[model samples]
Target: MNRRHARRQGMIALALTGAMIALAGCAPEPDVQPTPTPTDSAVVPYDGPVVFVGDELESFLLTPAEVAEAIPEATGVMNASAVLEQVSDGGGTAAVPAICDALFAEQSLGSVGARVTRWMTPSDPEYGQGRVEVLQFADEQQARDRMDQLLQAAADCGQFTKEAPVTFDAEILDEVDGVRAFAGTLLDIDGGYDWRVFQAYAAVGNVVVMLNQPFTGDRTYDAQAAASLLQQRAGDARDALVADLTENPPVPEEQPVTDAAQPWSEWAIGVDGVGPVLLGDAVDVAVAAAGGTATPPTFDRGPWIVENPEATASMLIQQAEDAETVWYVTVGTRRGESAETPQDGAALPALGDVRVGMPVSEAFAALPGGTIVDVASSGEDYYAVTTREGRLFRFDTEGDAADGTAIIIGITVEDATQRASLRFG
Candidate 1:
């Protein structure tokens, strides 16, 4: 067709389509957009204040030993809900002193968690060295029960004594160790219970709590009064806590898993020119010539060092000539001595020395930061083992490695386990 004819045809088709649209405007139409589904991201994280370690109050109904042992065998494998279930299993009609009725029950309140802020001993005149511990339980019911028991014990003890005519003004110290309660009680022999008060409330689930209150002998204040005070405080705290929790929740922190053996190895030893000799497997020496008896040092979990005078003579000469570091590593010795600075009697020659103790890990930690140079080579082990301070430590078997008793010479004291396996440099 010619161009003019085609243009005319197109115009006619456009007119027809416009006429159809105009007619459809009078008819009804169906909805086009579909309903949107919600996602996890659509829900926000809990908005709450950062809980300081020492902000909450914890009262224990059980002894420290009892509470510590209360975890089920399967706790290590359980989730939060599972752990909570286990905790609630044996927890009976115990009330929580630091929470409200609305928030104290596990069934109603759910689980809460927090960090430890402070620990203290109660200074009440009657009790001596009363041990109190504070922990942020993962469940509000847990915290409440702990506090409830604590208050109950205090009140029950107070009821034992008869009323006395003594009355003294009480003081509350903000001490972390709970000495304030003791000190206050001591100031007035008459007003014992009145001198100290403990209360717990929820601020946030992740908030910190204090545990340290000793029971002193003088029970002058009304026990019921003290218990009431604790209960009220707990209620107020719980409400505040719930409001805070509903607004803001705690976020899990990123925890970094570290190679326990190599954590300090590079920075503390091998990478920094700490050693001039690669002493993993290349130490040779004559026992008698090395100045001690012709016997190898015994290896154990404790530190290792040359304790014999005979070995000292040989090792000192070698160190003086080579200007290289020597070591005695042990696993069982106490702190304050290391390979670099052994106690005068503790450090002997590596050669024929009697086994003097050397704190292996400490010595490694004590090395002047830029000393050991790490050498990468497989030691005498079939499986992989970590190297520390440029020295790859390996024993004859995995059992030795697990216990940390690898014997080699020219090695500086690293820790107790390494100390026992001393070889002459």
Candidate 2:
């Protein structure tokens, strides 16, 4: 027999041995399904507020469009339910059966509900994979306990010799706040493949977010890069969940505004000699006004760049090809040991008298006549303020609201109503 056939035969022999052991009480049954529990009794009613009520997994889960943004070469997204069904039908390895048993065991996840999404490239049939699994629990404590269980399970199952001579090597990557990250490799001897996997777990309020990426290819995959990406994605997901839950929980109807608010269109920033610029202005006019040249378009977009001769200030502009208007402008102070102000006549772009480094309160006071519609935390110490006029300002605070100062860091102007509708509703 050929070497490949001989290897398959050997794997079959091992699998049979594993199956016999499993039947003899060494492993749990693969087909044991989780018992259905009443949704209300399963989880305690989130007492404070609800960003997501019921099982709207689609809203919190990363969509295929987002996956495309993260993994540019992603070909398609697979319905996680279908993938799970396939895994079930395949009658996975002996170890997999036991793992599922532990996962779905009574109270293991504490009234938890899960939804998964997977992104795949053309090569995924043989290698490469991306997936995000979100588990919503009864409370923050439950989510934390579940994460602990998952990490311990990974540690316990360090390696499996049955069914394909598989081996796992795992290491703790990082633990920030309540989030834990782990990275490892899976060696499949029978399949002739080595999979590099990175996993991150975070408990945000009453939810647990898990992001995992597994890749296999001819070229060596960088584990550090994969771990970093997983950590970033996990952190972003956790922040979004917390923001949604705490700031704008689900309500039956729109909350009435008690104070008068002005539109954001009145705000303007200087673009060099072009006088003042507002949202929806054409890209060429804005670039010329800023005394900068636009680069050739690629992927239907171009960037207008500006740099200070004295290395004190810089700006980057992005414009879309389908629209004549400039999209967004990012103005920032120069990095390193340089002094704050630009030399000679160079001046940093300004929204009225406000620029980066201005106190958060001062920036709002400088605005012509807009009301602070909402203030929400995006991540740890980072805050975003939205105005009635389609303007969003971001700031970083030292820590506490009373003792620490909030410094303006970035600003963006967009259609406020549309943005709110998409995010909150």
Candidate 3:
């Protein structure tokens, strides 16, 4: 495996190992309630809706507009599910099993509502990027419980090693107020660069907050800056939740469920230039559709990598040697200082007409039979839509819900979890 791929796999393995030790209940359980502290005055009884709608976060977290203002050129937002599914650059075989086991476990915040917005510089997209995730729990106690579990897990797995000589060291930083923070570093012995991450977790009544800032370059990362930012943002979120509760008192009654069926629209799945294509199309046809010149498939008995150098897009087409059919196709964009150059206003080559940069509202409007089965937002009126056909689309809007047009930032066909292994080899 290449150095990049090895490093990613190693980092994932280390995380999973730590999570396993933590989830195994290796540490003794402490008192569920935190010690009596000054911050206790800040806790407020949550009376808002228990079942959360993504946009409700605007009452407590930073809006998309706010994030864009802070970091211009910020791409669209990603909901909680999308964040969990974000794997490292190189697809590693060993990391997948571990990530699935730990990240998807029953108590791993899957029950709560969450969303993440990422920020990266135009010059160095890979290194100087950060993410903020807000998780809303049923109540304060549950959030605290989850935090405790994460702390225990971090303690049990201090350091570990994985294949490709990758070593990971995790440290539990000092706690602030009642919140806990941690830092981790991953180093590839043969690779030139290292990956560093700083995370802070705080529980404010029913809202649980997490701040993750990752740097993947040669320079020394500023741990203090990362921690301070986390503290500030977490504090802001906590205070906002409290103020919202006091200002807008919620009716202490359960929300009634609606039984009316939503209208459905039929969608044509194809890239604008690349007409409709299925999961198993040949590499050349798929590449041409993506606005790239076709090249002969090079088989080393593995997935073929196709690139549209001009469009800054690439695809990984997987198929077995014995079978004439393709198993799955994964497409992505290269973003960095030395990344590929694309024409102005060119759409990403993943799904053609429905690719990134398309307006979310316009994309949905084009689908005659598409029904929004689920919708989530992370402030700024951004939303993640799930269709009845299992396709996932994320949109980032510019203004108020009534007038703002939602731009498409992400799309996933079929089951994203199984995208890597859709068919047997």
Candidate 4:
């Protein structure tokens, strides 16, 4: 939540929100479309077949006409993901389910390919939202395992609590063409009626299709109809995926820039670079170094935070306050009595001088005071300061500054040096 950084929209937030509050009866959609941006003129030419997980998945997705066919009240259906720039730090959750804390628990496990199609009926007032998620597992057996997990969870997920009481129950309605349908009800925690919910799933080969749509109002959840639709779509996607695999087309395998044989990746976290990323790298380059995504420090594209789930460290990258292009990368770390702890991506201590799990004073001592550039007062207290030597970092301490045991909780090795001279004009 850096004041200077524009937070990326909460992807979990809804375009459905405006539609839900629309006046009763269908109406023309609000001007929810974004002012279009420049399209990349670089559409690389490719011969033969391409992988179905990315650009190809769109064709396999339910068409706008198809969704409109189901939720006839829908006024306009746009590519929610492509059109809307959401603020992820803002509150609101997705139709994302972890039903009974079992289904969708480990999203990454056995996942070979995945894609989502989100369509918002932004003027429907009801039945204007749904997500079609296609996930390819390692094999057919794995796909079935996911299906089994969901079914079992549904059986035991009669009730659960998420900040309040919720009652989610479902029953097998039908299974046609290998697609299983579940007609369910979602009861509001405030003792409301059981709202209808539709869940359709189908597994073909190594791929799985999940169509989840909540029955908001006049548009009821139809398990049978949805199941039939999913069965056909899943079968098609699976076939395409298999065909691609057989053709063995060489799609650019996404690899972190850090995975390359560069010494900078192992170098200390300095103004030059942090892990696989470097100071002033553009969004695309930094994203590549972060295993394909640089998580926003608070869900915004600006001030991107890169983390390695396998380790205990993280880094932040941000543009200069008012300029474009990335300015610098920061490694949030702490001082340590011992350097035994692991880092988020790279080896700790940033050249053995400053490392997380170390003492705050020691870190600051190595890189002394400078001009304060930013302040963090929410949830923590710290100062982001810059130095004449082209260094910017934040040190959040515990207890009094004099106490040796006051371990640092959050430390950032940021930079504002190079950005000071940007041509912001």
Best candidate per TM-score, number?
4
The model with the greater lDDT, 2 or 4, is 4
Question: Per-residue lDDT of 1-425 in model 2, one digit per residue for the tens?
Answer: 44565555556667789765444443333454689886654433334522222234334455677555545556668764301111112233445424422222222122223456777766656655677766544445545555666566556656654455555556656666545655455555574545454444444444555655555553234444444555565566556655665554443322222111221122234322112333456767666555432343444454555554445554545564356676555454212212333422124544555655665566445542222211122222323333322233333333422222555544433322221100000
Give the alpha carbon lDDT tens digit for every residue of 191-251 in model 3.
Answer: 3445444444444444455555454454344444444445555656555654665666554
Candidate 1 Cα deviation (angstroms), residue 235: 3.1
Superposing every Cα of model 2 onto the true structure, what RMSD results? 29.6
What's the ranking of the predictions by TM-score, best on top? 4, 3, 2, 1
| Model 1, position 172: C-alpha lDDT score | 30
The local distance difference test score of each candidate is 0.27, 0.45, 0.42, 0.48
> After best superposition, candidate 4 residue 265: deviation in angstroms?
5.1
TM-score for each of the candidates? 0.26, 0.34, 0.38, 0.39
Indicate whether candidate 1 or candidate 2 has the larger TM-score.
Answer: 2
Sorting all predicted structures by lDDT, with the top scorer first, yields 4, 2, 3, 1
lDDT of 1 at 352: 20
Q: How well does candidate 1 match the true structure in TM-score terms?
A: 0.26
Winner of 2 and 3 under lDDT: 2
The sequence of per-residue lDDT tens digits that candidate 4 reaches over residues 132-164 is 666544344555666766666667667765434
Question: Which parts of model 2 have CA positions greater than 4 angstroms off?
Answer: 1-73, 76-116, 127-130, 191-203, 211-220, 233-425
Model 3 misplaced stretches (Cα beyond 4 Å): 1-112, 122-128, 138-142, 164-177, 188-203, 206-208, 252-425
